[model samples]
Target chain A: MLTFVVFSVRRAWQGFWRNSLMSLAATATMILMLLLLAGFWIIQTGLNAGLQFIEQKVEVVADLNDNAPADQLLQVETTLRGMPQVASVTFVSKDQALQDFRARLKARGQEDLTGYLDTNPLPNTLEIKLKNPQDYGNVVDYLDGQPTVVSQVTPIQNLVNQVVTVTNFLRTVGVVVLILVGLTVLFIIVNTIRLAVFARAEEIEIMRLVGASDAFIRWPFIFEGAMVGLFGALITLVVLAVVATPLQEFMYGFFRVLPLQFGTLVVRDLTLLVVGAGVGLGVLGSYVSVRSYLIR
Target chain B: MAPGSSTGLLRHPTLAGDRPPETTSERLVLALRDVAKTYPNGRAALRDVNLTVPEGDFVFLVGPSGAGKTTLIKLLIRDELATAGQVLLDGQDLGRLPRRQVPRVRRKVGIVFQDYKLLPRKSVWENVAFALEVTGTPGRRIGPAVDRVLRLVGLAAQARQLPTQLSGGEQQRTAIARALVHDPRLIIADEPTGNLDPLISWEIIQLLLRINEMGTTVLMATHNAEVVTALRKRVVGLEDGRVVRDEVGGAYHRED
Candidate 1:
């Protein structure tokens, strides 16, 4: 068993270098296809993250009557916190609301005309965040039911429905596009490796004639294919590493308002995907190509 | 049993009724009985072909192109199964052999092509060693086996040269050495001398005769009628996918 593996690996190494041009061509194709797959994967991940960020922004805010008792405000806060659908609830006093209004106006370069008012007209507000944007309907209904404590709840149900519809469509489209790209990468990489194997048909014929077993004839080519894949994957990872910082900067700049970050988990997953696909497709392609010669 | 053992001998006193019986030491290396091969495209490449070769015999397969010579060779190596009957190599029915057992059977029969298929990048020594290497011979055994075959084919001095550096005769000898490396019971040479000059052709024929004398059977497919007629050995002639003639001390053509 050890002899077989050593022989196969040695032959595979020799085969790769002996046909350097064909081997390099196969590796080049693998790199390009893997890069395409990784690009689509990154885009898909970013789209998902951006969509969740948008969904998290779907919160229901209710304006409280100035005459509502302090105890009633506390009760509303406790009730919102106890609800399973609500993620969190925060209470803003009228003074704090006025201060926020003034700060926004000043930051927008508009004059602080609120300072000229005789009294603070802003109302205390209860801000409620939901676990899911789709669950906003239940929270809005509950807030609207508090007639004595609440002056008015923001009419955001239509806006939330629209956002959900658009996000779902985009998510579906992103997934479909990623799948199509993944399949394309598979075929292109497999075909490239097939071409490399086809170039060595004479070697396979000689091996078969010399009474080499099916494993003997097959494993060398498989090892060669794997070498191509490993080389291609390593090169691709280097290219990714070189461009990673720039790529992340470009993504952040492009989607300035979207919360997109390439966390360590994403990096690890991407590395695994590239390496796994490269090696898997390489083995699969060689197996399929060599099969035609062996079966005869 | 050892490959050349007399225990494996198949007495054909009844099988070949007209022919006189040979010494009891001779064993059958190859046999075909009513073997017919029809390819997928409805081409009948061979039909009703019956031939038998005993151990250590040198036979010439002579025929015109497209006369089932190639198909006959293909059948011996189990490259294609006979459609109608059996092809037995060394008393083993090739058609009944399992897929995994095919390689084991092939090692018993060494094959040589007209083109001398040697890997261009490898040296002559590596070319001969390749046969044993791919067959999983032990590393230490490979060197001596390869050296012995190279010495047998008289190419031991040119062991380090590539195929391109060798002459046509040398390349053919290299192929023969590779075929001999396995110490096969039978060696099938398909037009091995087709590419060489007349003098070099005789040299190859002499080498084959020497190998046959050393207790290895040789079956050569050839178009060289001059050598075929002069050798006066057993000749099996094929015409339009059927064996037209099979005779001992036969010439290239029918004497009567």
Candidate 2:
């Protein structure tokens, strides 16, 4: 087994170097496939982060009736929390709400709201977090159906609906793009290997004549294809890292104008993105290339 | 579904004294029963040809242009299966076996083509050793096996050279070395020395005859009349796919 692996790898190495330009072309296809995938994943990650932030912080603030008692407010909290999709619940009392308003205004360098108002008009409410981004619409529907308390769930669900629609649409587009790019990679690699095989169809035919088992004949080619993938991934990762250096620095400088996560965290996440994308693309290309040869 | 289609396992036990080969009964190594091969575009390459090569024998398949000699060789090796009739190897029907099963049967046979078919990037050693390595031989055994075949084909000195750097004769010798490496019971040479001059051609034929003398059956398909007339070996003639003659102790010179 060890000998077989060694021979297989050696054949692959020789075959790879024999057609260096063709191998490079196949590798470039892999890199392009990976780059597209990585770019999509990064966008998806960013979009996911932004969506979750809004989901967690945004909620409907339903005011209670003038005659309503504290028990009724607790009942509303209990109902909202009982739903399976509700991730979390936080009830803000009127007094605590006033204190928060004052603190936020002072932080924003604004006048105190308590001094201008005769009473605490801010309604006590529960901030609801849906189980998933997909469930946000259902959460809005459930919250709007409550009428025992006074009407109106806060934070205007229309804009939230629009955001959900846009993000979902983009997610769908991302999936389609991923599949098309994957197939393009597959087609390119398969054709490259096929043309390589065609160039030596006589040798391949002779190999078949000399009692070479299909796997035996296929091993070297598959090994070559996979090594092509690995090499392509390595080169692509290098290119991505080079390109990202300036981009990351620019992002760090620009995002510094606002309070956000550290550049260090971005680097860590992007590293995962690069490696995952590269390996995935390489494996995909290798698989399609060998599959076509094996079928013949 | 031809008559007498054999599908038994080739269960010959690896008996002692089998290495250097020995004389056996006039056992037919390969039999083509009215085999016909017609291309899809309606070119008749072989037509109802009946030819049998016995074990331990050396036979030259001789014919003129459009004689279907190469096609016959291809059919025998399963490179191109016969379109109509059954091709039997050691009584196993070649047509019945699956494509995957063809290799093991092929292992019993070795073939050297006119084109040399050496992987251009592979060194001569690698070109020959590739045949052995793929058949799952142990690593330690490969060195001696390769060396023995190279010595037999007189390619031992040129083993390290790439196929591209070798002369036409040297490349053909390397191919012969590769065919001999596995010690297959049968070897097919289809116009192997077609591109070589008379001297080199004679040299290759002599080496093949020596291999045959050691009891490996050889089927060499060629159009070289000088080789046939000079060697006076068994000859099977094909014309438009039909076997015109199968004569023992035959020569190539004949009236038009």
Candidate 3:
């Protein structure tokens, strides 16, 4: 087995170099396909992250009655935090609300009309964030039930429904597009490697006639395919690495405020994804291509 | 040159004198009984072809183009299964052989083609060593085995040259060396000299006869009547997929 593996590797190395032009062509195709796949993957990841950020911002705000006691407001915050769906609940006192309204007016370069009133008209409010935006029904219902302490709850149900509908649709489309691109990559890579194998049909025929086992004829091509994949992946990664900073900058500038950072985890996952897809497609392509010759 | 004079030098260390003796002198190296083959296109390539070649026998398959000579060779190598009846090589039914066992069975037979089928990029020595390498022969054994066969085919000096660098005869000799590298029980040459001139063709025939004299069964398919008639070996004639004649000490054509 060791001898067989050593022979296969040696042959694979020689086969790759001997057919350098064909091998390079296949590698170039692989790199382009992998880059396309990785591009879509990055977009999908960013889309998901942006959608999540938007969903987290879908908070249910309830205005408390001006006369509601501090203890009641504290109790409401604790109760909201206890709920599984409620991610966090922050209570803003009337004074803090007045201050925020003044700050917003100043930032927007609008006159602070609230200063003209004899008394501050702002209401103390509870901002409730949900783990999942779709699960906002129960939290809204609970806040509405507290009629004594809460004067009114903002009717954002329609807004939440619309946001969920659009985000869900976009997510679905992203996944479907990724899948279609993945399959396209599979076929193009397979066909490219098939052409390479076709070029060596005479060699394969000679091997078959000489009583080479399917493994002997197949593994070398497979290893060669893997070599193409490895080279393609390494080259792709270098390209990606070179463009990564600018790509991230462009993404940040495009989406501006969206939390779309390519963290260490993302980098690692992308590296794994590129290498895995490159090598996997290469092996599968060669396996399927060489199978046609071996079956006979 | 004499028929058996080259046998001494062609003797394989592991396969010639040191090889185990056969169980029977009459053991059949190849047998096709009522074998019929119709390709997927409904072309009946062979029908009712019955022939047997005993161990160490030399036979010539003579037929016009499209007369099933190639189909008959395909059956022996298990390249195509007989549509009807059995093809037994060394007494094992090819039709009954499993897919995985095909390679093992193929190793028992060495095949040569008119095109020479040598890898253009590989040198003559590499081309011969390729057969053993692909068959999983040990690296240590490959060099000597390849050297022995190249020497046997009288191409040892030109082993380092590529196929295109050699003449048509040398390329065919390289192919023959590859076929012999396996020390196979049966050597099937399908129009091996089809591309060669008369003089070079005679040289190939002499080399084959010498290999046959060294105790390997040879079955050659040819359209070369002159060599076939001069050799006076067993000849099996196929016409439109049927074996019309089978004769020992036969000429390429009928004696009538």
- Highest lDDT model number: 3
Give stretches of model 1 more than 4 Å off.
A1-29, A43-59, A63-133, A142-171, A179-187, A246-264, A292-294, B1-26
Model 1 chain B poorest 10 in a row by lDDT: B8-17
Docking quality band of candidate 1, CAPRI definitions: medium
So what's the TM-score on candidate 1? 0.79
List model 1 lDDT by residue over A137-243, tens digit each.
77888888888899899745455566567667866776686557545555654565566566667777898898999899889878877888888888999999899
Q: Each candidate's TM vs. the true structure?
A: 0.79, 0.74, 0.77
DockQ of each: 0.64, 0.50, 0.64
Model 3: per-residue Cα lDDT over A171-256, one tens digit each: 67766866676566566556655665677788788888888998998898788778888899999999999999999889977866
DockQ of 1: 0.64
Q: Residues B1-256, candidate 1, lDDT per residue (tens digit)?
A: 2323434322222232233243346678987877899999999999877788899888989889999999999999998899988788999999999999999999998888889999998899999998998889989999999999999999989999999999999999999999999999999999999999999999999999999999999999999989988987778888889877776666787775
Candidate 3 backbone collisions, by pair: none
User: Model 3, residue A149: what's the lDDT?
Assistant: 88
Q: Say which candidate scores most in TM-score.
A: 1
Better of 2 and 3 by lDDT: 3
